[model samples]
Target: MDVDTDIDKHFQQLQDQKRMLLMAKSRKGEVPRDRKPPQVAYHQFMMSHMFRAGLAQSNENMIRSAFVPPAYQPCTTPIMKLQPIKINQLQLETHHRGRYIVLKVMTPPMRMTGILALGADANGDIVLLHMYNQEEENVREATDIVDVGMIVLVKEPYYKLTASKDYALRVDHLSDMVRLNEDDTMIPPQWMSRISEIHDSFEPHKAKADASMKKEKWWKAIRDYTAAIELGPPPDRLEIIKRNRALAYLKTKQYDAALADTGWPGFGPQPAEKALFRAAEALYHLRRFSESVAVLETLHATFPDNAQATFNLERAQKRHTEEETGCYDFKALQREAEHICPPHLDHATYIGPIKMKETAYKGRGLFVTKRVKAGDLLLCEKAFALAYVPERDEERSAGNGDITLLINIETEKGFMGGQADLIRIIAQKMYLNPSVAPAFTSLYHGDYGATPITFVDGNPVVDTFLIERTMALNVFGCPNSSLATHKRAMNNESMVDNVYHSCGIWPQASLINHSCTCSARRSFIGDMMVVRATRDLEPGDEVTFWYQIPHFKANMRDKLKGWGFVCDCALCQDAKQTKATVKKERTKLRAALTEKCNSPVPSHKAMERLIDKLEATYAVSPDLVPRLGHWDAQMQVARIYAAKGNMDQAFKSACKVLVFLGFSLDDSKKGFEIKKWGMVLDYLIDAFMFIGSALIELKALASAKKAYQYAKTVYRIVVGEDETFEKTYEDHVF
Candidate 1:
């Protein structure tokens, strides 16, 4: 018969034998004396017949010849026949002079973040290979090219010698290693014959022994099962082995790998019921609750009487609904302020209302394409990477040797400079997520020239100087608010003191230029920074925010030193032309206002004089006097009126305080929710309470109740469900 006809006949005979054995077992009411199943026996019988016929030299070769087409081989080059030395022969005495070696992998590749892997050859010789290149594109390509149990040809291999004298072959370039498939014609016949013997004799016995010892020695069981699977066991046995490996993977917290073993296509037949249940459990641990629920639903449909499947299905469904609605407590991220804030608050990152553009004077600036009003959210940014600056006392008192040693090592490696710890953290983040490297490289690195170097794959290096300079010009120092500070206390003692500052890079927000008279003010709610318009802005307006405190006594020169720029903004330019006059006037006005504010019982006339002095000083140069002082002056006037029992004047003054702090009387005009206010929240809440008390004294009961309710809402947002403030306000109003 022709080859095709003969193969079909062989398969038909095996099927017939399997059917007869299964029938005999059913009649006898147990597996006939031998413990082997019909499917396993049939596979072994077919393999033995092929070996005796000599149509192919080994069972693996025979199976490949029957299934794989000659024209569809993985590699089609005659150069593959250039015989390579075995991995066992790769020693420093003979092969260290850059000789090539060919190896068939025996164990699963141990990958370290997709950059490097430790692989074992057929003879159990381990070698280290670097899998990434200098460019991020090349690094991603290398990760996709390598896998476990593939035959590979390495060229010009070198040894990396260590203190213990244990050496490994290193392959650096993508061209140095070539992956080969089992069906390739250039495979050496002797190696194939030995592999077949090892598979039949050693692998089956090893699998049985490992399965027996699985309960007490699960880690070893997983290793042995992986080896057996790589050796090409019989089809029925392969399914059983994969299921066993999946269970061990789940126990070890390797959820992704466990899911792959149970559900990956072409590994073997469909996994049995037990394996499917294990896959659902794996998905649940990975926090993919929706997928876990779906898998459990399928299991319940197939086996309606399964009590465990029903219980798990209900649990997964409930968790999936909670995750979709953001109802969980977020317990894992309580200490991390950046993670405590929900991503949905940052609309500018996900929503497109503004774009960055290049300017002649400013390197880059953010411009608004849509019209925005006062109290509108112009931008909300989440940090790309963040690191906390430890308090001076905490650093000196730290007891962990590993942390101290790491700092010393970094200093020796030349990462020590201004903000070196922050630079190191950002560099490590870029290395771990290569896709973000391109955006990071595009950021403006201050006036320093490029420092390029040759690439080494295994020991990848980042430019620390460039990272430090970029961060110096761009990072925002965010203060932890009272709300975030209280939440952070649930996780660690290090963050209990709210005085520590956390620094981070908001890549898009960095484009906004500095302005003393900024149109927008920035506030932090956890790690989320919300930028709202302090005044109405038209389309095409350059969106700007304050880089430093606007009311500080320092001149523009001192404030702009770290930024490496001159004072060119309208306020700075005005101050520059009349520096002496502006400085003298600001000092006089501030001194007068401070004295009046500190009085035990200030008169209404003195408060009115303070407001007039602030208005006149603002007229000279608005930037010289910050807007925060104006709000403080208005609050003082309101307190003076309330103290004198002048309810009408107190209500008007409180309303002005709210407006100056970026609150709108018309609720429809406000862009941001009241809960998003940062440091100003406490002041805003107090102003509302004052307004409510004044209206009550005036006998406007309905208006008074509305104002009190708004105050309660803001208080609830800041302190969560604790109702101490709400109860006190209600009792006072009643």
Candidate 2:
């Protein structure tokens, strides 16, 4: 008995020693990395066992259900099935012909101006149904609700002779079609059996296609859908498959393929109205504005009340007009830009005569093929990809619950994740349209090297790391125009609480070299970038735009950090040669001039001295200073002259500023207004207002009235006609 007790005590001592060792290791933070504690081990073991059992049971249930199909579940609402008529038995009789028939969709619904489908009855007799003049609400609701293998009850469907001279059914009203669920008892057993077989054959491919779509594997989705389509399901199912394939093609930027799938034969007129609309959309993207317009016009003639058709038709017409005329109304563009979420301008492309050429040091640079005068449109580019950065609070809710997932993208600004959001969107776009991957990858990735991953569906997937580097080097930050911001401010309730800083990629614009004294200026109208020559340039002159303001106080090294290059532009080179004494003198003069301009009532002598000093500095070292700074100095001098009631001097000084802005203001004219001012529209407005106010003080009422009128015209051009501007100075000229 004593020996038995001693053995038990020894076992207890061993157990205690094991526990103590474990506790010491844990306290020292040296717990065995691969081992779990007893509690955790037990919990994990139970979870694994339960998971296995549940999975087994699920598989068993699935197997059982596959063999013995569940009973048809009826819809909660009672539906009376009209007497079904066989497809082949239809006759062209006024009363007896137009009867209800139950049919299953064998093809996808093809949309043009209307939804078209070919459905089959239990007898395997097929008929085409053209649902035209569908209401917008009904079409939107039907997008997800209508699909292949759907059992629908058609009521009051009239027969029509197609171009092929075949009899078909026409369904016009939304009420005429009632789509029944898979388990609906309304489906005939004979039809159900056939549908079940078709479903079984197509299920695998369909599932794969759906999974690929969710993963944004557009090419895979297209391939799978095409395979399923070739299997020859019913007419409605075929249409559905074709539609899905078309969507995949569209996402991949294969506009031609998309159009073909929408029912446009290689050589023929437009297909059904439903498919025609899609063709028009594809044509629009391909920049075939005229073709798109023609199709839209035909669709509009058929369904004048279709809002979407009308809207697209008008847009096509506008794009066609712009392409032909090379003219754009800024007022209309501003209105579009003011939207919180603006529609993409995918139809816009590079419209100027510029080409990319390799440079000695710079990888590539844009060059002018023709002489460009000041204010000439150099390049108008649409963003390849873009995103609006929401406010801090709204960032959590901005995207479709994927915002947090996207925040993991690495960026230089580590904790500041706004750029990650933009790159995330670019990645999503690339995923949807893998064909654009080449163009996106062709962009300079700065210092970051590409880390290649395994190919997906035979195409290399874009790395987020490459995208982050490219975006950092090339993204343009566009602020909302003052006019847009002002309009938003006017309507408090309608205001978009977040001020979105738009980031966009202009692949072509990214080629323009950087210069402190740039010859071109860029502006944004929505996501579209419009670049105009700030100075005249001869043919073969490299087009350059300022990446950073020339007057910025930072040295070249500091300013060029983001650009990842030392600017060897003329201005920077000249700065290197300038004497320290001259630099100090210039800096002091600039400070004095700035102080004078900020004063409420600056002396005319002091302003004159400031302008003189600026002129001297420019004359001595033209390359060291920007002409824009000189223009600003002149503007201040003009304001000082105007304040001193020196109208003549003010007009002359203002004209100097106009010359720098690429405008020739002739004071000898009655109105003293040029036909066009090359200055930015916003600055032009201010210049005219200042000139008009000075004229009013000079008692030149007639001239002042003309100036005000010009201001009003410009105001109309900048802001849309929705709001009227109250005239500050009124005059009546008979």
Candidate 3:
């Protein structure tokens, strides 16, 4: 006995610990670290056990029962089946010191459970039931048990009922008692007084109320019913009386009262589905789309496949989108402008946050009422919104020929003419790569400028969406007419420019005015373009980034010229003289290198000499060689040589020009370099995999397995999951 006691105590301690662990996990705050691992394992083990036991299956009947009234149907599933028995009268008892209504009932042999329940037998003996604890092994043997023909008693308490589902029941404990033997001898003075007062009231008043209700004078009839309820017992017919009263209340537009009466104890306690729908409808009527969405979202979470909830949710979400883009309040704009723009145009000031105002037509790009900085991210649009046309088969077949390129150009111009200028704007700044060229190559004619168009009043309205890309230039003041343009312009300059551009950023460019000798410059980085103050200007001074620079490399100058505006900018004015002088110097360097290559020096000695001269010239003017054509051509040749293991030539070629091509070293070979590196990485990843597979094919299991592991590590890094290197360390090392 002592040993058994000790064992039971140990088991109880383990069980208590497990319960504590479960409680900790279910708590709102973080669990203690020492407890977490064990809890996780326990939870996973339990889940697996339950899954194997088929315990995870949905209890469809329980779910239905939650929404349905109990009296409306039998216990929904076999799990809740009640045993049937027969009885008659019930005795009710409670220790609570309050006035309560006793409902007499016969306790049947069936198992009845509920704190407050209305139970009925086939013989029409309706009982207000509660749990009765009889202290005997068998109910038949218990002296307190109510046998057949004995009435069970129950108490009804008064409380104001509300609309929510949770408050439907009136019970303090699950095990409150009821007995089938009616104790009429124990009727209290309050019960007798209630019965006496009810019986003493006017029957004519009730007849009059019933007549008014039949005539559809609902409000008055309800008033009469209230008086009658106090005068006598509630109409003996539960369903018919309740339904008639509910209809009368509804006819009087007393929805609250109708809902209340319907949700009373004897009636179905509110139609949950209809209540949810009504809530959604009310929220929509109030123009509270987010609230409507929230209600529908809650419904969907509880009932995911509910068609009405899904439909309402979609409607609300769509309304939200429309509201954001359909209407532009100019008053709101004026107020924001006053807040964001500086008081004086003379001083650099904070132009407030500018976002798109609603446009009248499709393809209307970003619009801002307040001033914006040069490098600010006006908006980051997904590609789908941008206007584009598919590349034609003929264009694709042109195999990089001029005619195919020309066809691409025509298609782009046609779309722009039809009011989609996104392609044209992009083409002005980006030199089309082979990958994107087919789609947008012909979009920009030599004369086309970078402007977004919106259709207003049946006419095309062009607006400047971003600051024009600018390179080397001195700043100057802008025309007053062009103030809006200058405020939102993005100066397109490479990283090497004193400006900074990050794709998703915009800074002081919002404040800067256009100038040939601007004190500030901006640069682009992916989606961010940043304008850093290169030179300070006095208050009210217009900030400007140079629209053009003369001494910039060949492709840079060409791109600016393509904007079709004359080079009245300072850079263009001086670049002609600068270019001639640079050309003469470059010619002299080339002659020296060629003569050295032809001379009878040892091959290694000659190569060393060439390296020194090239490095010096490249350091002095890296753009010299690549100025004659596209910079990418030179870089591509270098990459090809690198791939073939001609490391000397590849390194020399890349070093000669690619390094100094852009403002920041990071930006110099960005777009093209990403593509180039991607190719090389792909090859290396494949090679590792191939080597592993080859070993496996040859049945060299040990080597094959090791190679496979190494290959996986390489793949992981390529996919940007470098931490995986440590995960498979053993496989690679072995």
Which runs of model 2 end up more than 4 angstroms from their true locations?
A: 1-199, 203-240, 244-279, 282-314, 340-347, 390-418, 445-455, 458-460, 482-500, 596-601, 610-624, 627-634, 655-685, 688-734
**Runs of candidate 1 exceeding 4 Å displacement:** 1-361, 364-383, 388-424, 436-466, 480-499, 511-513, 516-543, 565-574, 577-579, 620-631, 655-682, 699-734
Model 3, 1-734: lDDT tens digits are 00000123234434444444344335323212221233453344345445533531442111000010111100111111222232222111212222233333233332211122343333453433333212212212322233334333322321111112111123321112233211243343343343432324535446666898777666556655555555555444433344455556555434444444543322233334544544555455434567667767766786787887798888776655534443222233323323431111111112223333333331111234444332232221112112111123342233311110001111111111101122222322122111222222222223335333222222222211111122101112111111122222313222222221101112223223233434344432111222333322333334344444323243334645433434333334444445665555655654654565456542434444544443453323332221322223334444555556664455444433333332112222111111111111212333334444444444455655554554443333232222333442333332
Candidate 1 — worst ten consecutive residues by lDDT sum?
Answer: 64-73
Per-candidate TM-scores read: 0.49, 0.57, 0.24
Candidate with best TM-score: 2
- What's each prediction's clash count? 0, 22, 84
Candidate with the larger TM-score of 1 and 2? 2
Cα lDDT of model 1 overall? 0.53
For model 1 the TM-score comes to 0.49
Q: Rank the candidates by TM-score, best first.
A: 2, 1, 3
> Candidate 1 lDDT, tens digit per residue, 495-569?
433333355677877888877666666655455555665556678788777676444355766866667776576
Give the least accurate 10-residue stretch of model 2, judged by summed lDDT: 63-72
Candidate 2 RMSD to the correct structure: 20.9
Clashes of 3: 84
Give model 1's clash tally: 0
